[model samples]
Target: MKQLLLIIMLFLISVAAYAQKVYSVDYQNQADVKVFVVKYENQADLKVYKVKYENQAGDNNGKWFFTDYSNQAKKKIYFVDYENQADLKIYFVEYENQAGWSKMSKKQLMY
Candidate 1:
């Protein structure tokens, strides 16, 4: 039972570790993920929430922090002018629980 519990814990840890670490890039060409901010929350593929602490960010939960340097970020993202040009369309949610990916296929774009 202990071994099974350990395996389950490990699986959860690995899953949590896979959540994309995001960074804001200066230029679009330098970014790994291109994002667009949608006007309406219903139109967004992902709902984002800015977290107060960096440690709180995880699990497609939209906990984001704007890092000062590019090197400090895990996944460098560029904000695009048009939604059609973006790899992911996001809406900033006021509440943390409201943040999550609406499109499962687009999840890979973050990682």
Candidate 2:
């Protein structure tokens, strides 16, 4: 019984250690957008991006950015450090199919 209990405890600990979480963020102070802080166990990197296609210069590409300076949702494609959770806003933009960075707009972001 002692060995069995030890095995069970080990299994639970391993499962808890390997779990990863996803967060949703918004610029509002209200509860409309589901936002949560990420606490990494160690040195790690988390990326957030929007996957979409739009006609621009006759090309296509996958799009992703860390965080832009402003939360206006209408601006260029830029990345800023992820600091304040309240300033985070989901921005969306259109880009050439599989091309690269293009014009970023507020409408391009989502949950």
Candidate 3:
């Protein structure tokens, strides 16, 4: 029974760890994180990949699953017009395997 309980707790922890559901808000004030899309990957703080399914979302490692509703998302983000105005700068990657944090110091912004 103790092993079963441990297994259940571990499963729940893993699920919570990977929940990177995000929503794009229209206004900067409505966002949890202000994002700027960098043209070059080298310029980005994080390399993001848009995952089609919510289950495929990464554990704050840049695999983002966009939710249809803001309430359903873990984080609400706004895209800034300029890099200087942003709290986090990201580059969209072409492949899932390429998605991850380039600068670890900026990682807490997503959380």
Candidate 4:
């Protein structure tokens, strides 16, 4: 009976592990800066990552991602999805006067 319970627990754990969704930022093709809107499978938190990319070194660049429940200005990535191919891929750029983070539309994306 104990062995059967252990088997059931292991099965449940594996199922949970299989449920995660992940996306890759096309850094090579992104704007100078890219905002990646990552939605978690848990639905408990919504995140917008601000990424600053450069064409200089191969590995390091000035990428940044920030979010606050502060106000509605940061709602650009509120509805992004990884599974849907139509959804925006993660990347960053500079906004108009805002000067810090910018959301790139599907057309503006480098890739």
Candidate 5:
């Protein structure tokens, strides 16, 4: 009975861990995180690279695989009209090797 309970608990934990749902709000006030896309990698607080597969996505790392549907996304992001409205500013990098958070303080925004 204890083993069965432990297995069930583990399953619940795993499910919760994968429950990264992302929604893009039309307004900045409705968003949990504000984002900015920098024109250059050097100007970014976090350098991001889009992955081809969801399995390749990392924790608070710039490896993002955009889901075809919003429901399937782990992190919902809304692109604000202005830089000041964003909570987390990101720059898309050309190379996967360049993907990462330059400012560690903003790392929690992704997770």
Candidate 6:
């Protein structure tokens, strides 16, 4: 029972650490990740869905909750004007189910 409880606790902690609670920073230098919004879905590395609540945020799976304050966020991101300048290129999806990393190679950037 102690081992089971420890495993469960570790799982929860890992999930919380990976939560996609993001804040948009005013400057590129202030950001943890530099992102670009792609015009087309095919051009994107990740498809994002903005959640209304922070609890609805995914584990680096593109379901993002935009935090009002930078301190409240798990990741601070800057929206880059050009795709070439971005570390990650994303497309906003209409549905939550559509949110996920398209290019698996770039998945580590979220972590």
Highest lDDT among the candidates is held by which one? 6
Candidate 2 per-residue lDDT over residues 22-83, each given as its tens digit = 12234333233332223431211212334322111111122332223334222233232453
Each candidate structure's TM-score, on Cα atoms with residue i matched to residue i, is 0.80, 0.21, 0.86, 0.23, 0.73, 0.88
Please write out the lDDT profile of model 5 over residues 6-96, one tens digit for every residue. Answer: 9999987664444344556566565667888877777678888877777767555677776676667656788877777777788987788
Candidate 3 residue-wise lDDT at 26: 97
Clashing pairs in 1: none
Model 1 regions lying over 4 Å from their true place = 1-20
Task: In candidate 4, list every pair of residues with a backbone clash.
Answer: 33-92, 33-93, 34-91, 34-92, 34-93, 35-91, 35-92, 50-64, 50-65, 52-63
lDDT of 6 by residue, 60-86 (tens): 899999999998888899999998999
- Taking all chains together, the TM-score of candidate 3 against the true structure is 0.86
Residue-level lDDT tens digits of model 1 in 1-111: 999999999987865654545778879999988999999988888889987766777866676766667776667899999989999999998998888988888877765
Error of 1 at 49 (Å): 0.3
lDDT per residue, candidate 3, 1-111, as tens digits? 999999999987775765689999999999999999999999999999999998888889899999999988889999999989999999999999999999999888877
Q: After superposition, how far is residue 22 of candidate 1 from its true place, in Å?
A: 2.1
Instruction: State the TM-score for model 5.
Output: 0.73
Quick one: ranking by lDDT, best first? Answer: 6, 3, 1, 5, 2, 4
Error of 4 at 76 (Å): 21
Candidate 5: what lDDT? 0.73
Candidates arranged by TM-score, highest first: 6, 3, 1, 5, 4, 2
Task: Provide C-alpha RMSD values for all models, in order.
Answer: 3.2, 15.4, 2.8, 15.8, 3.6, 2.4
Alpha-carbon runs more than 4 Å astray in model 2:
21-111
Write the number of the candidate with greater TM-score, choosing between 1 and 2. Answer: 1
**CA deviation > 4 Å runs, candidate 4:** 22-44, 48-111
lDDT of each: 0.80, 0.31, 0.91, 0.31, 0.73, 0.92
